[model samples]
Target: MVNILPAKEIYLQGNEHALLLLHSFTSHTRDMKKVAAKLHEEGYTCYAPLYRGHGNAPEQLLQYNVYDWWQDVMNAYQFLLDEGYQKISVIGISIGGIFTLKLAQLEQLEQIIVLSVPVEKEPEQLKQRIMDYAYNYKNIEGKSALQISNEIEPFTNMPLDSFIAFQHFIKDTMLHLNKITIPIAIFYGERDEDVYAQSAETIYQQVQSSKKKLKGFANSKHLMTLGRDQEDIMKEMMEFLRMNNGDLTQ
Candidate 1:
C-alpha cells in the first residue's frame, strides 16, 4: 500500500487561486515558508505538503519513494479542486522541483515554477561523498555546505535501491517533458554543486511548453530560494505567476 503524505494549508485572503508548494527531499514545509509568505502577500492561498517520512522522523523515509511523493501532490491538487480553486499553480524546490516537472506532464496544472531541480546527478565519487557526509554529519545547523550536501543525500542511509529509483524517475520524467503544456519557469543556481548545470539547459531545450524560461542565479547555491538572491527570485516568481494567471497577482 502506498502512503500519501499529508499537506498543511495556509490560507491568504484575496487570492482567487490556490498554489501547491512542495519542498526538497528530507525537508519540511518550512523550506517554502518565505516563498509562501510572499505569494500570500500577493493574494495566493498556499498549500505546502510534507512528503511521506519527511518533517517527522528520518526512519519513516524508508517507506517512501518517488511514487508516494507524486501521490501526495495528486491528493493536494484534488483537495484544491474540491475547495473551488479552478486555477492552480505549483512551485517545487530541488527534488520537489523534479516532481513538479513530472506532475506537469499530467496536464492538470496551469503553471509550474521549479527551483534548483535535480534533473541530473553528479559523478559517482561526488554522490558517494554526499552520502557519506549525510550519514556521518549530525550538526547541520549554520553549516551551509553540510546543509546543501544533505539535501541530495537520498533521505536515508540505505543506498543503491533509492539511487536507482531516483535515476529512473529522472529519466522517465525527462522523457515525458514533451507532454507538459503548462507555462513553466525553471530557476537554477549556477553555483549548485549537486545537480548538473546542463540539467537546466537540457530542460529548456526539451520542454514542449512554448512559455517556458530558464533563470540562473550566479551567486546562489542549490538552495536558491533561501540564498542571498531570494528577493530577486521571489520577484521573478511573482511576475511569472501574474503573467500565467496564477491568481496571486490577479
Candidate 2:
C-alpha cells in the first residue's frame, strides 16, 4: 500500500514585510511550519512553499532538478511581491539554505538567513546510502516503504540525476558568493550530522556582505530548526529581521 499523505502550503498574512521560507531537499513545507508561525506572530507575513517532486512518491522526485526547486521558491516569492509586499526576506534550512544563497546572487531582497547550509559537496557514502535504499525499497520491512524511509531522512531515496543536479547547483552557487551584498545571517549546528560544523564560518568568510553573522548552536544536529535550540534559533532569526528594520514599513 502507498502512503498518500497530504502536503499543504503555508501562508500567514501580517505586516508588509513578507518572509519566504524554504525547506530542505525532499522536505515538505512542514519543516518550516514552526518557524513560519513564529515569524507570523512577530507581525510578518510568511509563506512556505512545497518544492516540486517533494512530499510525493519517491520515484517522482527523480523528475526534478535543483533548478525546479528554485523555480518553486521563486514562485512563492513572486506571489508575495505581486500581492504588494515590498520588503521581503528569505529564510532557508539545509538545501533550502543553498537555494537561498543561490537566490541572493540573483535577486536583491531585504535580507537572507541560511541555516545549516552545506558549502561543500555531500559525501559519496551518504549518496550511496540513499541510492541503496531506493533500490531496496520493496524489500524493506514496512507497509509503506517510501513513508518509512522518509521517517529516517526527508527523502526516501535520491536519484542519481537529482544528486548530480545538487552538486552542480552547489558549485554554481559558490562561484557567485561575492555577488551577495545583502545582509545575511548563517546558523550552524556544532554537532550537525549531515553538514560540517565549519560550514557556517566558511560561508561567512566567502560572502562579500559586510552585514553578516555566523552563529553556532550547541546540542543541535542537522535539523537545527527542530532541535534543542529551536526557540533560540527562532529568537535569533526574529532579532536579525528586526535589526534590518524588517518590522518597519508595515
Candidate 3:
C-alpha cells in the first residue's frame, strides 16, 4: 500500500506573501509539501490544494478534466487573496506547472516558478503513466484483481478524454505563454526526458517576461521537488520570490 502513496491538502499560514503551490498530475498535494513547509519557515504563507477528482481512487481522476483543475487553481488563488494575501505568487511542477503558466496568462501574479513543465506531449508515455496510476491505486486500495481490471479497463485500451484534455491543455498554455509578462523562473531536471529540457527552453523563449531565468538541476528528474537537489531547488525558489515579489512595479 505504501507503494501507492496518498496525500492531502496542506496549509501553513505565516505572512502576507502567499505561495500557491501546485502539484503534478497522477500525484497529490504532497508533491508540494516539502517546499511549502520550507517557504512557511521563511514566513511565507503556503497553500497546496488537492484538485477535485484527486486524492482518491485513481478512477476518480478520469471523471474530471484539466478545465476543472483550472477552476481549482483559480479558487486556490482567490482563497489566498480573500485571506488578505495581496501579494501572491505561484509555483507548479509538471501539469501543475502548466496550470501555473495558464494562471500567469490571466492573473497579475507577483512571480511564477515552473518545474519540468511539458511544452510538448508524449502520448505513449502519458498513457502508460496514467494507466499505471490507475492500476496501482486500485491495487493499493486492496481491491481484488477483478475489481482492479474493472476500474482500469477504460484506460487499458486507448487514451481517455481526460488524457486528451491534458494534451490540449498543454498546447493551450503554450499559446498564452507570450502573454505572461511578470518575472518567471523555469527549472528542469537533467535526468528527465530530453523533451522536458526542450520544454524548459521553449518556455523561456516564448514568455514575454523580461525578467526570466532558466536553470537545470543536474541531480533531478521530472520530480525535482523530491530529488537530491531539492534543498537547492528550495533555496532557488525562495530567492526568486524574495527578489521579484517585492517589486511593486510589476
Candidate 4:
C-alpha cells in the first residue's frame, strides 16, 4: 500500500454530502478558493486537496509521482467518510481531473466534474514546446486573467521523469475508464492549446456512465475554471449537482 500523504481541506458545512475540489498540477489549494467559497454559499462542503509536491517548494514536486498524488486523494476520501459525509462528489481541474477520474474507478462516487483533463499523451510539438519552456528556451504565456493568477511567473520547471510518469498515468487511467460508474460532467475549452479538446470528446463518448454531459467553452483555454467563462463553468456545475440532487443547495 502507498503511504498516506498530507493534504489540506476547505470545509463548508452543509447537508450530509460534500464536494471535493482538486486543483491542477503545480497549483496550491488557493487555486480553488474562489470556487470553494461559491460552493460554500450554495451549501456544500468543499474539500480541496493540495496534491503532493504542489503549492510548496518546487523541489518537493521532484520527489513525488502520480501514485503519491492518488494516495492523497484516497486519504481525503477517507477523511470525508470519517466525518459522516454519506454522499460525495468530486470536481477536479487539469491533472486533478485525472486524479478524480482515477478516484471514480475506485469509489462509488455520486458525481464527478472534470475540467480540462489531459486524456491524451502530449503531442510531439506540444512536448517540444513544454521542454523548451522548461529549459528557458521559450517564455510561458498567460492567455487570460485567470491564467495571470494561476500562472507561475517563470513556469515551474518539471522533471523529465515526472513528465514521463504522467504519460503512464494517462495511459493507465484511459484503460480503466470503462470501470467508472458515476455521473460525469466534463468541461473543455474549444480553444485549449494545452490539452487537446479531442480528449474531452473521447471521454464523453467512451465512458459508459448513463448520466454524462460535455460542455465546451468556445472562447476559453486549457484553464477553463480560471479562464474568462469561469462563472459559466460554475453555473453549469451548480446545475449539474442540483439535477443529481447532489447540490448542497437543497
Q: Candidates 3 and 4: which is better by lDDT?
A: 3
Per-model TM-score, in order, reads 0.81, 0.85, 0.90, 0.80
lDDT of 4 by residue, 20-106 (tens): 898876566765777898887788888887777765544455577767888898898898999988899999988788889988998
Give stretches of model 1 more than 4 Å off: 1-14, 122-159, 246-250
- The order of the candidates by lDDT, greatest first, is 3, 2, 4, 1
Winner by lDDT: 3
Least accurate 10 contiguous residues by lDDT in model 1 = 134-143
Estimate, for each residue in 1-250, the C-alpha lDDT of model 2 and write its tens digit: 4446757889999988889999876567887999999999888899998998776655666677778888898888889989998888899998889889988888778899999888767545436644554545434434466655555454443445666667877878888898999999999888885455667777899899889988889988877888899999999998988897733644
| Per-candidate clashes, comma-separated | 0, 0, 0, 0
Q: All predictions: root-mean-square deviation over Cα?
A: 6.3, 4.1, 3.0, 7.5
- lDDT of each prediction vs. the true structure? 0.74, 0.80, 0.87, 0.75
Looking at model 4, residue 162 earns an lDDT score of 53
Worst 10 contiguous positions by lDDT, candidate 3:
241-250
Assess candidate 2 and give its lDDT: 0.80
Error of 3 at 115 (Å): 0.2
Top TM-score hit: 3
